[model samples]
Target chain A: MTDRQDRKAFFRELGKYSALGLEMALSVVIGMGIGYYLDRWLGTGPWLTIVWIGLGFAAGVRSLYRAAVRSGKDLERDEERRRKPGGP
Target chain B: MRKAILVLLAVAALPATALAAGGHGFSWFMMLPGGERLFYMYAAVFIAVFLLVAAAVVVGGKKTEEMVIPDPRFTLRNLFELILGFLQQLAEDIIGHHYKKYLPLLGTCFLFILFMNLIGLIPGFLPPTQKMNVTLGLALVIFLSTHYFGLRENGIAYLKHFLGPVWWMAPIMLPIEIISHLARPMSLSLRLFGNITGDHAVVAGFMALIPVVVPSVFMGLGVFVSFMQAFIFTVLSMIYISGAVTHAEEH
Candidate 1:
């Protein structure tokens, strides 16, 4: 491939791949944010915050897993197509 | 749909009303002549501009794709193709073939929020998004609309989504679902508001310090942040909407 085309491909992959990480991180952060506030309001003294953070981590990991599987399927599809005759 | 629109507008307008009505007490000094009235008008004006552009695009563009327009000028048709085309790609990328029906809503949203965010970079104007009321308003519309789409797609069985996998966990699961679901809008609004407000403040701060050079730097950053926030908001909204419909396919 040409250098310019390679560079464009690199950036596209970079952006596409990093979005999963960002989404995962944001999920945990959102969980923590909600947990921290709920703790403060309910006077749970960190228990709620702890629980919410845990939930947040679960949510993030769940999203990451979803993303990984989705990308895996896409890559497999691409490979299958490439193995086919007359494929791009 | 009309009633839903009215409700969303009313919810969106509530904070502006309270701010204007109660301004005599706390924010008397900060109040401009028109006050929150003017604050809300910026969004109104954006909506008006959105309608105008859409109308122009609809009129200017040919109905059929076969009609050729090579490198068309900076006309509404070109602008329409550029934005709508990108949004179409975005929706399809995120949600697959289920994307077309949502294009108009998502397209309008991206265009409106992107412009609204950029407006603050210009001097003597505030981005409607900086106000929690406006952000909340946009979020509420998405929140309700996504649920509507979810229910339509999945049937009333969608409520099982709130209930956990095991039936016994419903009590614990429901609240978590509600809070996390509610947090979608909270985060959506606050993230946009916080980023834009912080960016605007820094730009204004720098503009005050050295009106000539430094603010331009912040202005450039504002452009980047504005686009990123718009993108994040749009993509997240798409994810939430699609998740409601396609939960079974993912796992």
Candidate 2:
């Protein structure tokens, strides 16, 4: 039972970090697609596509930044644990 | 754009299921988005869901007493309490004190998904979540519900949440928000589909090659994957709901 819980915790950690990369890629693709569709519907050539790409790119960056900062905090916490006197 | 992503994701996610069906579902058939009618995967999913709901209803919420020998079927109340207790702890841990309001949604998502994920582990049955439509449908529900709750909580100002912080960033933030939102369903669908398909395929392959020996090991992994995927999905949904409903000041 304890082993199963341990494994679940391990996989839970794995899923969260792995999802970060996926979020980065899909966000841009989604943005570009939305932009392209809007441009096609409006008969406005590449303008909307260009605008949508920028938004997508920004959103992707924002998400990545948050993940990076979060993981960094996690690292900082680990470091604190290590540096604490009498820490195992 | 979504149609293209949906096809690409569906195809990419379930090549293993195709191999299991001896070359169907996951191949060029998926290119025809609504072509799910050709497979019984959807029906299997509904059956699984129906069974789960019916059982939970029948079981009701009986309180558990200590049992000398704990069997899942024999100790129904114990099973219910264990699952409900775990889910409550998970909800409070992830979504905080306000978790009570969101408990029903999260609990249903977890239980239904856990059921769907487990069905494939039963031989001769294909899980609904193995299909693009099933996972996509779930992703859409989470997406819509989170936004619905968010809007209900924040009113018209909810629209401004997409505008982002600086007034000048509105034009940039809007499309980005839309793209990010679009990506959620894509990511959710693809993740569940790929994980379940991969697990089921490994078990099938082992069962074919060496009977139940190697397959049992992988089946153990399948059980882990089944529970973990459901947990991840529920947690992500909770995070989304909480984020949407949070005050602008917190943002």
Best by TM-score: 2
- How well does model 1 score by local distance difference test? 0.69
Q: Compute the interface RMSD for each candidate structure.
A: 4.6, 2.1
Model 1 residue pairs with clashes: none
Give me the displacement of residue B224 in model 2, in angstroms.
1.2
- Runs of candidate 1 with Cα error greater than 4 angstroms are A1-88, B1-33, B50-54, B57-71, B249-251
lDDT score, candidate 1, position B204: 62
Per-prediction TM-score, please? 0.70, 0.73
TM-score of chain B of each: 0.79, 0.75
Model 2 chain A weakest lDDT span, ten residues long? A1-10
Question: What tens-digit string does per-residue lDDT give for candidate 2 at B195-230?
Answer: 998887777776556552466698899999999898
Q: Could you tell me how far off, in angstroms, the CA of residue B2 lies in candidate 1 after the best superposition?
A: 59
Q: Write the per-residue lDDT of candidate 2 for residues A7-63, one digit (tens) a residue.
A: 544543565566767787888888888889899899999998987788788878877
Q: How far out, in Å, is residue B212 in model 1? A: 0.9
